[model samples]
Target: MSCQHEESMHLESISQSSTDHSLVVPQCPDDLFVVSQAVKRVKEFYAKHGEIKESHGWNHIQAVCDHTRKALLALDYTIQDNVVVEIQLAALLHDLDDKKYFPNTPPGEYPNASAILKEFGISPEGSRKNSYEKIILMISWVGCSENGNTVPKQVKDTDAYHLLIPRWADRLEAVGSRGVVRCYQYNQEKGLPISSPASPRPQNEEELWAKYATSDKLQEYMDRGGTSKDMISHYYDKLLHIARPPKDIVRNSYLEHQAESSSKDLVEVCLRYGKSGQVDKEYIMSLS
Candidate 1:
């Protein structure tokens, strides 16, 4: 969502419960305060056990927040009673109980994350609980079943897709700059190779195909040689699939950034490490 950034919200006071390790917002939160404090609490909350994965750690949350702001700014939205705030709030806590980071929490249960929300009086019967849980469930990976949202009760004209605004915002991070960072980080954490002569820079489209590309799905692509366990392979299989902006407005902005007479060089921009981070350029494709 190549949108202008949204204004920042502030959280004045937040503390963790020592007796129970649950977070407590210092104030009787207004919508802005609840959302802002939730965002502030994510890092500490997840880091409490010291097992947060670097790939999806607090920093990833910040990136998604930035992406969320951009998405909101790009939308031709008409708000109905702080729905935007609720979307962002749900986005803020999207990964609170992610299986990758909080394996013990498991699906079908809120566990510790629910306790944090409870301290600020966010629960099933709380004022914002229904909306909060709704948005969170919608954005979560497990929220969908059979390619449709688990909550399939469509609403008025635009609200039917209202939840998708935040959903798209959150996924933006999975494809672009943040995606590359995460790919490399995950490879490092899992001890996967970044690149080698065997998996050198892809010289053709077929070579760049994901290692998981089946012979049937992408026959020609599968014909190209590759090792399935490398970092580049992992990206080609998953992250690159999300490189293009999913929304029309955001896609328009993304196209504007594409190089003249080029296929956007999306991967190159990421592998370039646009923000001065690590990069691997073994692929021979020329990127402007």
Candidate 2:
């Protein structure tokens, strides 16, 4: 089936089912084939590398792929089928070489993702005219100290518009209540506290990375059982700022507005709990 969600759900519901079962690949044959292959590869990768944290685990990949598929459907007239394939593949494999997991891999190298895509006939070289690597480089919003948290220079013109779908879709997953839960989960895994009354909000992405990133820093947080980095601080530094002003790549006022509203809800909950260690009943009722 061309439906990413149906294929994903089947994969989940079955016991190691083959990608061919009930699959009806058609039209964009390479897209269907590559996506199916990508799904299988990601499942295997996460099964091995996913220590225990679900923060950037398989579920996150599924959500991002779903978001990308939906977002692209709205711009179907402008995007090509191959571009759709590239974007979805980027979303599915975005975290494979995450600095959090594969700390030794250099930024933008994407060894893990590169290998998987090569197997699927997608080479990882911008000079090769392969848009796969460009999409991969464009979708990452973290772990590149040189690039900060923005689109890279490699993505230009229409490719910029096409590549941005996965990036923003991934960002959408990191906003609102889901983002709060993920932050708490990651903190618990790293032995960081849910909240620290003493630490200040991070001044920039550099400070954020310096404090709570990399395998070495993860070990330090585990050993110390804490740091200035905490779940609340993470919200202030990153999660709270999920929505940004529209850029040239793409603009969806509805999505931006929804992200802002959801972020506000998360911020209110964070503020209430950070202050009193309990949710305000009045606010909870208002959400209902």
All models: lDDT?
0.48, 0.58
My TM-score estimates for the predictions, one after another, are 0.63, 0.70
Error of 1 at 60 (Å): 1.3
Q: What is the Cα root-mean-square deviation between model 2 and the actual structure?
A: 8.9
Q: What does candidate 2's lDDT look like per residue over 7-109, in tens digits? A: 4444344424433322222225456776787788888888887573688898777766766655654453444456656667777777787776676887558
Q: lDDT per residue, candidate 1, 71-188, as tens digits?
A: 4444454444356665665566676776555657655665555666776676767676777476545445322111122223453343455555445544455545555556566667
Q: Which portions of model 2 show Cα errors greater than 4 Å?
A: 1-27, 125-129, 141-159, 199-228, 244-250, 277-288
Candidate 1 lowest-lDDT run of ten:
8-17
Q: How displaced is residue 116 in candidate 2, in Å?
A: 0.6
Please give me the total number of clashing residue pairs in predicted model 2.
2
Deviation (Å) of 161 in candidate 1: 2.6
Local error of candidate 1 at 43, Å?
3.2
